[model samples]
Target: MKSVTRSLRILEAVAQHQPVTVGELTKLFGLPKSTVQRTLVTLNEAGWLRANRKDTTRWEIGARVLAVRPAALQGSSLFAAAREPMIRLRDAVNETIHLSVPDALQCMVVVDRVDCTHAVRTFHAIGDTSPLHATATGRAVLAHLPQADVEELLERGLERFNEDTPTDAEQLRAELRKVRADGYSVNRNQYRPDVCAVAAAILDEAGTPLATVAVSMPDSRYDATRLPELGRLVAETAQEIAGRRDGA
Candidate 1:
């Protein structure tokens, strides 16, 4: 367990000072150079750290490490506000409910839920980050961001999460325009195949989108007949939450 603690300490040091070298890590942790090198190698093998492909002397946290921070946001007030609403939505629709907030450059899930009666459900965890152009929750929040911020994010580029995910900036911008006009967003198999999601922006007193609320289910369960109802409920719930915040 001592060795494990040392490994975790190394990880925390790297996370705190990114793009660090083995020599710098050794100095920071007061460990021998050989010990730092061995720990870095082990971490690299475990997908927690990776040598900079361009400059082999430096290292950076890997995708696996990036994947863990979103989970840690679950205890935040943003998560607290969305939890009960998500649970209620899940029970009402007998589907999955997801709550997400805009992190620096991505949409991070704060809450994930599934109704007990639903035999088939998408099991997204609390820490997942979905593409801004793919998930309905992302689109809903993105639609409300400032145009300059939107342009900056689009310039950073969009990755296709699934075949249906939109990678074209112009197309996504146009779609976001429509979402702004309609006050909600809907996505089908954009992030995960066979799943459909509808989302609306949860606004604060100043009308800023503080978070997003989304309901997701298998395409079979959220067919054309049921989608409109689900979308309406999602939007209403978001508006209701916004109303409560304004009143308070």
Candidate 2:
């Protein structure tokens, strides 16, 4: 029974400070390194936690947790508000639409998705996470965040996923400025190679970003000439979702 309780506490700590290291978790829980490592291994085996893709030494929440409590992760009202608009966006653009919320300034967590009919469309599991500096969905949320918060996130060191990823702080800051000015963000093979996307953030009454809505597709089907239209549609869908969420 004590072991179960300890494991549960460790899981909560991992979710709160995710992409965390075993050494860090041990220090946080005042447990021996061996004990913490054992618990993490147990959780990983149970599908409640997994090592970060970029840095295997760190851990993050797993898809099984999202699969088990989808409604809670979806934030009931936000899910309902985003559903129809996301569907409409996918139908309009014939690309997958994703709704993702910021996980602190660390990453964006995909909470919902409407898939396109294309056999080769881009895909992200509901619990998937991506860096704020490398994804259209992540940048859409990052662009609206406060300057201090953005700076703090930049200080964390952006991990490069592809040659096109903007790892320099100044370069990413400029891109965030563009996202703010254009009311949308575009990513081309930045996070995931050969995937392209356009996205806009859903803002609350205080103008704080609550989540982001993105239209994603494979580069093979992406048309540079359609960017303006795609950006407009994505931005409009984000606004519609925000309005519905507030009204709900």
Candidate 3:
């Protein structure tokens, strides 16, 4: 039990200061170097932490650690409550459906998804993260975040994934404002030139955005003429999820 407690503490410390070094962990935990090293090795073996591949001197949260989600976050059990509605929306549109939440990495991570059976469809795997400025799924969540958090994320600078990605902070700021006004978000070949998507935010009881529900399809099948209709469809589905979450 003591070892489990220590492991959790070390895990939290590593998460707090990611890409941390062995010497730093030793100093932070007030443990002898050898003891810290042994603990780290044990945790690494159990898939809780890993030495950074780019810089082995530093450590990072492992893949398994990221994959293990608790039942709820921020007092919201959104994933379980969102499943049926997501599947319904996917069937209605016959497109890939993704439920994403803004994560610690300043991006949106897919928490759940309903796959599209069409030969040509957009597929985003669970646990995959997308840039806030490049995907509708992300921007839908970002548009509702606190002002300070938005400013801080823009200050960090956007990474250009493709030609359509908004690298300028002001440009993304303007786009996010549009998202708020439109009550939904649309990504037209921004994340991938061949893909397009629409998204709407899911708010909790207090109207705080917790996650986003999205639909994505290939650009070849995208209909700009029906874009507004698609957006409305997504928005209504998201609202349904929001209603269920709030009632819960």
Candidate 4:
């Protein structure tokens, strides 16, 4: 029990200060170096922590932790900042709004949602995962990521979930470019059949994407003429959330 507690604490510390060293963790916990090293190793073996790619001596939170419990971050500043804006976006667009964070370039995990009053609407449960190349929420974040990282993900193969899913590398790159230019992404039956969505990424102070805010609805209700309006609304909401998150 004591060992489990120590491992959990070390994992949380690694998340807070990623690429941290055993020595730093030891100092923070006041534990023996050997004990701290053992706990880190245990967490690493369990897929909760991983050694930094450039520096093996430092540890960071692993993909499994991000994949399993995105909802656990509901208490985080990002979630707190996004909640009201998401609601307002939903009210304005009359569509379900989602807040999703990237999962190490593997996919986007939904962390929060604000549902619309429509009887027929699209929905993604909290913790739902979506492909980066196929969804508006996913591409909104993907468009802002480093090109090398984006290339690495594309090299893994873009599985076509629907006819609209952009499988060609050059074509997807073009779409990403448009996303960067437009400040938002649009999905028309791309990931899931008959679902349409518009989304924008929330960026950190470094201009790196932190999460995405999306407005989703059934294709029957989608109006091409409303794209500009809906896109603008989602983008502004995302910006507001980012500002609030940074305490600006």
Candidate 5:
């Protein structure tokens, strides 16, 4: 189990800082040179990571890591439609933007992200899950899902992530109501203590939410005074995506 944990950390580092050299990874983890290199080799052979062609000694996340990603997100109609709006939102807000799709359960998977240029920013790693009740994107997607789906998640139990994370099913339901009413959701240091995010859902013609687009920033830059304006920006971006047809 410890070995598996170490390998996952290495994979995370590779994902976080792609094209990272073995020496840099070893220093990043404060692990032995041999161990880091060994893990990198294993991950590469497993197809979860790949060596960078420009620098054979460095590595980047590989295709296999995206094997589980939703097909709609990969240069497909959904991707094409959402791309422009997501990029525009990122440029408009100057904050990290996330595009996520909800799972069958209580988590939402990040499908795309645009990082802020600021030195301080939150990185929502793609292909990773974030709890529904603790993330703005999560809540945005969840709010538009079938009521039975919401109930099923409540039955699965809401694991607390931080002080601001909503654990009570009733409370979360109330918030979902507000998300539906307002057409947006906001998380203030809910998932990560230092991060705040605002999100809006992108729905299909059937009125079902297919995904969410969110903007996140460090708490240091967050201002309660600006939430409404930022919320509007994110909601408008999501609406734009929702207008695109599946064949678009």
Candidate 6:
């Protein structure tokens, strides 16, 4: 079991920092050189890691990892469950509604959407990852994560995208607490200037965060005065999605 754990850790480290060398891995994990080399060899043979023939000493993640991801994600009911609610939320708010799922340590957008009324508006593309401390959708998902995971993210530190982005861990934690109490999160020009968003988490039967549903609009359309109402709509929509998933 310890060997398996170490092997998985090596795989995770490689995945997180691809095209890494054994020496880098040894330095990063403080592991013995021979152990890292042997683990890499086993993983490479199992097709979980790929090595460059031109530079056999370096390695990157293998294609097998990505091949399994789509299948697993397809098995999830989030897409089917969120499609209608996303459309309705977009129409109700005359804005874009996005569905994002946690991918590794970040949240990635699985759907890009816009209301017919706002067809010209720019929208986040599917597969775009939101900053955890800079966007409402990201914060909503983070608010539901385990405290350990949250602390890990904080220790990694927040990346600043704009003036409103929270770079302080304590402040971000306070905001997450507020989100937990209010059942929704709001971001105003934290990610994109002149844009605003409100988001809430869709929970699974186990009360785990399945995804985040968010409505985004221009600051002109969704100002501070209307944030509470927008937040309520997002929370209700997320709850409905969660309930349907639980029932299913």
lDDT of each: 0.77, 0.89, 0.82, 0.89, 0.84, 0.79
> Could you estimate the TM-score for every candidate?
0.69, 0.78, 0.76, 0.79, 0.71, 0.70
Instruction: Please provide, for model 6 over 44-115, each residue's C-alpha lDDT reduced to its tens digit, 9 standing for 90 to 100.
Output: 888678785346678887644643454356556766677777888877878888877765354445454545
lDDT of 5 by residue, 86-130 (tens): 888988989999888765453577888888799988887777777
Candidate 4: list runs displaced more than 4 Å: 1-64, 67-71
Q: Poorest 10 consecutive residues of model 6 by lDDT? A: 103-112
Instruction: Name the runs in model 2 displaced over 4 angstroms.
Output: 9-69
lDDT, candidate 2, equals 0.89
lDDT per residue for candidate 2 within 26-142, as digits (tens), equals 889899999999999989998788888668899998755755565685668888999999998989988999998876665687888999998888998887878889999889988
Candidate 6: TM-score? 0.70
- Model 5 score (lDDT): 0.84
Q: How many backbone clashes does candidate 1 have?
A: 0
Which regions of candidate 3 fall more than 4 Å away from where they truly are?
1-9, 12-30, 33-76
lDDT of 6: 0.79
* lDDT by residue for model 3 (11-44), tens: 8999899999889999998988888788889988
Candidates sorted by TM-score, descending order? 4, 2, 3, 5, 6, 1
Candidate 3 matches the true fold with a TM-score of 0.76
Q: How far out, in Å, is residue 182 in model 3? A: 1.1
Deviation (Å) of 30 in candidate 3: 6.2
Which stretches of model 6 miss by more than 4 angstroms?
Answer: 1-75, 112-114
**Model 5 shows how many backbone clashes?**
0
Give the per-residue Cα lDDT of candidate 2 at 212: 94
